[model samples]
Structure formats: structure tokens, C-alpha cells
Target: MTNLDIPATPGAAVARTEASPVGRVLAEQAVRTAAAWLAEFRKSPSTPAAYARDLGLAAVVEHHQLQDLVEAFPLPSVRTLFTRSRARGVAPELCWFPMLLDLGLHPVLDATPAHVKGWVALMDEHRDATGQPVLSPAARARRVAALSSLLRWAVTEELITANPVDRLDRDRAGLVVDRHHSPTRGLSGAQLDLLVWTADRYPGPQRARTAALVALLATTAIRVSELCGLATGDYFADTGRHVIEVTRKGGKRQRIPVPPAAAARLDAYLATRPDYGAVAVPGQHGAGRVPLLATTAWRPGAGRRGGGQPLSPGEVWATLRRVARTHPDLAHLADQLHPHQLRHSVATRLLEAGAPQQHVQDLLGHVDPAMTQRYNRARDQLHNSPTPLAGQLLERGLAALDQDQEHHPAG
Candidate 1:
């Protein structure tokens, strides 16, 4: 490894060129911080490897993933590679994160342009036994973005003045990763209606629960993990409005306002559930607050008095699949539909209705304004929807307003 002396105060000439030392402890801390950052910025729509190609949250994520190539590289030589001890991913949301995180033995400094170029060359040339390619071009791009992310964060904390990775990123070709325009694919309002309607008509005690689940999935747009975390005690209602107190990813609870229709569905479901703090009994979630939604298997155990347990994520998916399967129109989606897709569907609807991007971002817990803009842009470029018709309506409305002003001659 080549050592580049880092100046105490990096001058303008060496600002983006200097290399500062990063000890094993700092590298490990960076991984933890990077993970928290990714979770907070997960809703950002841009791909760090492709679109931004610079220091950003996505860039951190994309770059950090490569830090864990520990199996391929030893910890002592490449301390910069975050060896993750043995955990594959830092969080469940990002299981794809390479498990190569560790508090390595040496110090890692800020990457220089030469360092980035060297890393790229290694990725391109290095191959496992049998000459099989290890990191694909796309994978390499992701890790580069990941590295950029860490350096960018380092810069933010004033740990580094600039991210040298930016210098080499411009020279690299085919560094961009292929990305889907919209992960929702496109959830039309009609299909969303069918999803809710199908669940609503379910002929069982859990019918209301399923209906509420689908409705809230589309309307509230909470993550499935958060949905499953809901307890009977979480639903807060007042004379003015109804809201669900959702436990966010880090156990931070936030009250998300629910529309009247969805709230009504929730009430209908709770009408059949056991009271909060149901009597002590086995199979109950915690012998505490009952789950807002329960599985059919969670019957009245022993004396039919126990509070049913929270519905598992698997159960939620099963219910969604059942809803899709029951409706012939939605049958094709049975294998493809997921709860998160509905969240996207909600964003689409909100943007289509001309809601402010910031308001929508707040509603969805998106930290980046770029994601909100992407959602609007996706809706704007819709070829399937009646965008042309809407344009025609606008033109006609403007002309009608002009004629009315001329005829009426308002004072």
C-alpha cells in the first residue's frame, strides 16, 4: 500500500488529493454510522452508483458494500475495507451488504484518486479460482458508490475536506448501474381499489383485519415491518382526527394520521379482537397490549381470553397473495404483489393529486427531496395514464377562462 502524507490543514491543491488516517476503531464506527445513514436515507430514489455518482447517502451505501470483501482480502493489508466481523449486512433492510465488516488492525486514510483507480483495477482484474469473475461491473459500481458514501460522510463530520473518489468517478465508463424507473412498476388506482375491496369481502372474522391491512398499506404507506409492530395501544383517535402510532425502524414511534375510511376499517377489525392487556395466557404476543392485527391461528387460547399475537410479515404477504388470488383481475399479481408496492402506489396517487413533495416526503418518512422529485417525475412521464387528456383539459379550461373574462368584463 502506498502511503500519502496528509497535511494537518489540507491546502486547496491537496484538498481532494490528501489521505488522512482512519484507525480500525474509526472504520468500524464509520460502518455503524453508514448503516444508520442508509436506513434514514433508504427512501432516496436515486442510485448512488449511477445517477449522482458522487458523495451522497446512496454513494455511502454503494461504497460500503465493497468494504466487506474481507473473504477476498486480508484485514491487515486493506484496513480500509470495513470487515464486518461476520455479520453479512448491518441491517435487515440491507441484507445485500457484504459481511466483510471488521475493526481492522491498521489505520485507513481518505482515499486518493490513485487509490480509487487502484481499487477499480483490482476489482476488474481479481477473480476467484476457476477464473470466475467476482464483482460484476454493476457490483463494482455499487461498492464505488459505497466508498464514496463513507468518504462523503467523513467530509461531513469535517474528518476529510474532500472525497478523492469524485476525481476518478468522472473518468470511469459503464460505472452506472441499471435501475428500474419506478419500483412500483405502476399500481393503478383501480388495482389498489380491487385489493382493498377483495380483502373487505373476505368471509371470516379476520375480514375487517385484512381490509384494514390493505387499506392502511396503501393509504398510510407504512413499511411492513412497522405494520407488524402495531399494537392495539398504538391507534390514537381524537374528536378531530384518527392516527396510528407507528413504531419506526429504530423503535422510534411516530403518530401517522389515518384517513377516516382506513380508520373505520381499523375500528371494525378491533371490534372483534381481545381487549388490551388480555389475561395471562400462552401464545399471546406479550400478555400486554394485543396486536392491532392477528392471525386466524391466534384463536381464543385455553379460555378464549388471551390477546392474540401480532401478525407476522409472512402472514401479511399471505393475505395480500390471497386477496390477489381471489380476484380474477388481480390473479396475475398474486405472485408479484407486495406490501411495499402499495406504499409506492400511495406516493404516486399523492403526487398525481398535486400534493407538495415535501409534505409527501414527510408522510412517507423520506429524508431526501430527490426521492419525492423522482416520484413526481415518474408520474409525469406516465405513458399509460391519461396525461395527454389532462393536458387537453388544461388547455380547454384556460381558453374557457379567457372567453368568460371577455364576455363578463368583471369590474
Candidate 2:
């Protein structure tokens, strides 16, 4: 039996634990090693909460009987699972944690193939309070993939004899199927037009800003994260085209060309700033720190001032929702509209307009051309639908037959 001391904080009494060498040994060294790895995996403050949660789970498993923990684990209520499933725009990592915690299957040496199969079955049987399936097929596959990776790592470290998850058939696990052929997710042309129109006329302090944001999103197709991260210095005129430099997902910086209409709206909105666009200029010393879409700052007597701070991603999402709800024309889309959908709409529109596949891929900052190809194929299918063409042909043939009968007096 090894004694492990886990300190809550500096100068605090250490919490001591004694490991049992029986079923599913939760080795202290393994916990310590995983903790160190997870700490190093922390990319930003935004990510530490998740790492801490993972570490906490490891701690819980360390102090408990593995079989007892699995059997007595309090699974998340069906209502809670449904609530999480209904949420839009949740981070993928965040979505996996609760489900993983509910399973209560800790990584340990004694964890067997049968145990893993049981866990998978439990997931398959999970239903919402209303008796609807909680996890979609794609979502189930994603959870399994995340678990498989973790178990594969444990196997490599000799913590487990084999990965039980690897033994599960891919198709049975809801993986390796044609799940990608689902309907295209984006606003139609009319919905998009109404959305922009509403934003342009939105009655509030955020009117101009919202309008500019909509135009920029529709044209540039930048991710919401990249859009929120834009500083004053990020936009500039290059040659005859207006360009905005953005750090895309995975830390790759790229310059995206802004359409003339979007660029004009953005410029007009910037000009209305209290600083007259001076704050957004890159080389203007302290002014370069100004956010392109700044949050409103309220003071005791200063009323409201814009351009003090950058808008958070949540704030951006809320703003779009607010605009959708406020405008009668866009009310139908209030629940469905989101920033990423704008990205999808742009990709689809560009592909339909005959833009080269590689160019569309670059515009969307996609690393894989295969993703862009999906959009292209969807556009082709929409245009080449036989139903509409067949209708047109039938109409023409009927008109010709009517004309012949009229000329020949067919009585």
C-alpha cells in the first residue's frame, strides 16, 4: 500500500490516501503523472477549468473502490442530460465531461473489456426525461472516440491489458457510418436578407455595430472567435482590396478579403466611433488596443461609451439572438440563427456562385479540402434537382399541345 499526499493549497494540511492493491488499482503515481500531463495540456485560462475537473475526477477515483464507485455513481438525471443536449454552441470538450463523469468508469489496471462494453451499453440506453434519445448518433460517436483515445493512452502506459473500447465494433459504436449526409445547416437567402435588414434597423446603441457584424459575417465567414478577437489594427487596405488579418483556429494567421459592401459598412460604422476610427488604427500607439466591436461602458455621468473593451463570444451570440427576436421579419429564425450558421451560409453561397473549391476552403479557413467539397456538392444537388427541371419541361410541353389544338380546331 502506497501513501499519497494531495495538498489543497500551499501551507495546507495534505490529504492522505492509502491505495488498495485489489480490484482496479488506482495507482498514486499514475494520478500524479496524469495530473502533470493535464496541467501541461492547459492552453489558456479558458481551458484550465476543464483540466481541473478532469484532475478532480482522477482524485475521486483514487480514493474510492473502483467497482463500488462504478456501481454507486450518481448518474446525471435525464432532465440534466436533456438540458445539456438542447444547448447550442457548446464546446465539444465541455459536452464530453458530464457524460464521462456519469459513466464513473475510471482508468485503472483492472478495468476489463466487459466493463467497457457495459459502459457503452449504458450510453446506448440513456434517454431523456421525456423518453427521447439524449445523444444523437454523431454525438455518441464523438463520446466513444474521446473515451477510446483515453483508454488507448492508458493501455500504452501498461495501466490496462487492452483497450476494451477498441474491441467494440465501429459500426455498433455508431462510428464509420454516413452521418455526414444530413441536411445542410444554414439560413436560406430570404432569411439571411431579413436578418441583415433587421440588424441595419435594430433600435439600440448596438444598431450600427450589429449591422456591421452581420455584413462582415455574411461576407468574410470568419469564425465567431476570430471575429471577437479582432483589434483595430487587424483591418487594413491592401492594394485595391480591403483585407482583415485574423488568427484562425489552431493559431494560423490568415488575411481574408472583405467584400466591397461589407468593407463600406464596416468603415461607416468605424467612422461613427467617438474617436473617429483613430482608435482602430494599428500604428496609433495605445489606440491599437481598441477592439473593433467594443462593449459599451457606463459611468456615473458619462452616459454610455463604446470601444472600451472587446465583446465576449457569449455577448456576440446574445446580440445576434436579440436582433433576431426584436425584428418581426426575423422572428421565425430567432431560435435557429447563430454565428457559425453565417459561416456556413457564406461557404454555401460562394460554392453556388461557382467559386473554386480551394478558394472557398481558404476563405473558410478550413484545413481540409474535403469539408469544402461537401458544401460544393450540396450546392450542386440544389441546383441540379430534377423535380424543378421536370416541372419546367412539362409546362412547356403542355403549352405546345394547347397551341396545336387551338390552331387545328380539334373538335
Clash counts for all predictions: 16, 0
Residue 20 in candidate 2 has what lDDT? 32
State the lDDT of candidate 1 residue by residue for 333-396, as single tens digits: 8987887787787777667767556666666665556765333121111122222222233334
lDDT of 1: 0.52
What tens digits encode model 2's per-residue C-alpha lDDT throughout 1-411? 211111122222222334334222323333333443334332222222223232234333423433233333222111112222223333322332322222332344334556456545655666679996565665556556645655666777777668867778868665663533533478765556556656777897667888888777766677776787677787886555666777554345566666665676788788777744553343332323566777666522323334366665556787788889986667777776778787777667656656666666666655656766433121112222222222233234435545765899535
Q: Give the worst 10-residue stretch by lDDT in candidate 1.
A: 99-108
